[model samples]
Target: MLKPVAAIAALAMIAACGGSGADESTPPEVTAAPAATPAPVAASTPAPAPVAVAPGEPSPEFASLPAPYNAANYAIGKRTFKLCQSCHLTAEGAGNLVGPNLHGLFGREVGSLPGFAYSDALTNADFIWEPHHLDEWLTNPRAYLPGNRMSFAGVRKPADRDALIAYLMLETGYTSAEGDAPNE
Candidate 1:
């Protein structure tokens, strides 16, 4: 009785995983070892497929991702940063409180805010905070770049995130390629 049910379920899984999508061409591994008395159930479930991301690159955002990291966006970022004003400051090289000063975020290492007690999650991170990375991080923050110290859920507005990154780009002195634009 149990063998009949298990056989039906195994057939279903084989059919489902036998797709030519992302996992196409990959051979399936046998998890349930063949047994003398005919085992009751599939011992272990097949591992779920990995999510596909573009190779060797970060996901792009904004137009040109607003690179040269626009001055307008930086100014806009300052204003949007007002949302953070209660807890943060954006001068030259500041520190943290409810949050950090955010003085030099761009080009800076992730989770590398000086003097601030950072989470173990960020301190070990290997990625640099760049315009593209910042956009991604600010997009969903916790989801985008997990392990960040920020407790505030995150800003949902893309424009606001853009502005904030632009402002940080200016502070970090990651000079933009945009012509004739004085960084804010």
Candidate 2:
């Protein structure tokens, strides 16, 4: 009986030394908790930094677009761009489909990309592809330039057009500040 009581007391002491011995009346001390360790990042993979973008401007990459333009905007813009994807390829070095490959379209001349067949209406048009011009073209392609080869009716909603253009600007590496003068 004496040996069994001593054994029980030793086990009780061990239980108290462990964390599980706290009584119901005593609250756990938060300071006693171990600090959280952050997940380690792989050295080879760097996160994208946000790029500054002004209102009515385009970003070079979707991940780099600043606060007002977030991943949500990219998602919406990406979905909107599906309307144009059937005819265009926004990726770099991608071949032209039914329409021209739209890589680097923002600053290029309307019909200047080589190899792709452009309609006479587009070829004759004298305009560089800036945001405003793109907006107009998207609103009504054939109306913007009669006899253009694009058969699909243009995007009617201004917001939808804006989103699609934003997506295009991202995929094509267009920077809002590309041609801007230095503040200095």
Candidate 3:
């Protein structure tokens, strides 16, 4: 049973990437994994969606984030970040996963994290990570730089990309001052 479930999930991922020769006009639906059973709740009360920080009250870790990035956007970005959690980690001192730990990604040089084995395409590139660069990269990593190891099809929506970038900036310790530096 477990094997069958895994197989179905794998197939779903492939189909989501347009691997099944599905129609191109309609967007594909991708499920990372089978859903787990929810715990029982009282009939009168429904489970509320998880919120990382309450509206109007940002978490201490993200309180310094500037305007246009509020708790609401943070929550959306947190949810969207689920797509990236399997490959990357945002916490400081957390070692690399399939991708590098992204604690200070905003101002860091691309592919320059100390321990991870970056692709030659990235390692040979000369550039720093800024919000705009990250936005383009997340829009389509493969198109942005070929021969990289990441296999994500890329986030297709601009709004999602914005939210994800904002989330990354907040989580990865981006400061307004970093935005002032010219990308090299």
Q: Largest TM-score belongs to which candidate?
A: 3
- In order, candidate lDDTs are 0.61, 0.73, 0.77
lDDT for model 3 comes to 0.77
| Lowest summed lDDT window (length 10), candidate 1 | 54-63
**TM-scores across all candidates?**
0.51, 0.60, 0.61
Ranking by lDDT: 3, 2, 1
**Model 3 per-residue lDDT at 129:** 86
Error of 1 at 82 (Å): 1.0
Candidate 1 overall lDDT versus native: 0.61
lDDT of 1 by residue, 51-156 (tens): 3334322222212434444423434555677777787766776556687666766557777777877777778878766677666666666887577767666778
Question: For residues 29-117, what per-residue lDDT tens digits would candidate 3 score against the true structure?
Answer: 88789878999887787755545555434444444554334322566677789999999999999999999998999778999999999
Instruction: State which candidate, 2 or 3, has the greater TM-score.
Output: 3
Where is model 2 poorest over a 10-residue stretch in terms of lDDT?
175-184
Cα displacement (angstroms), candidate 2, residue 98, comes to 0.4
Off by over 4 Å in 2: 1-72, 177-184
Top candidate, metric lDDT: 3
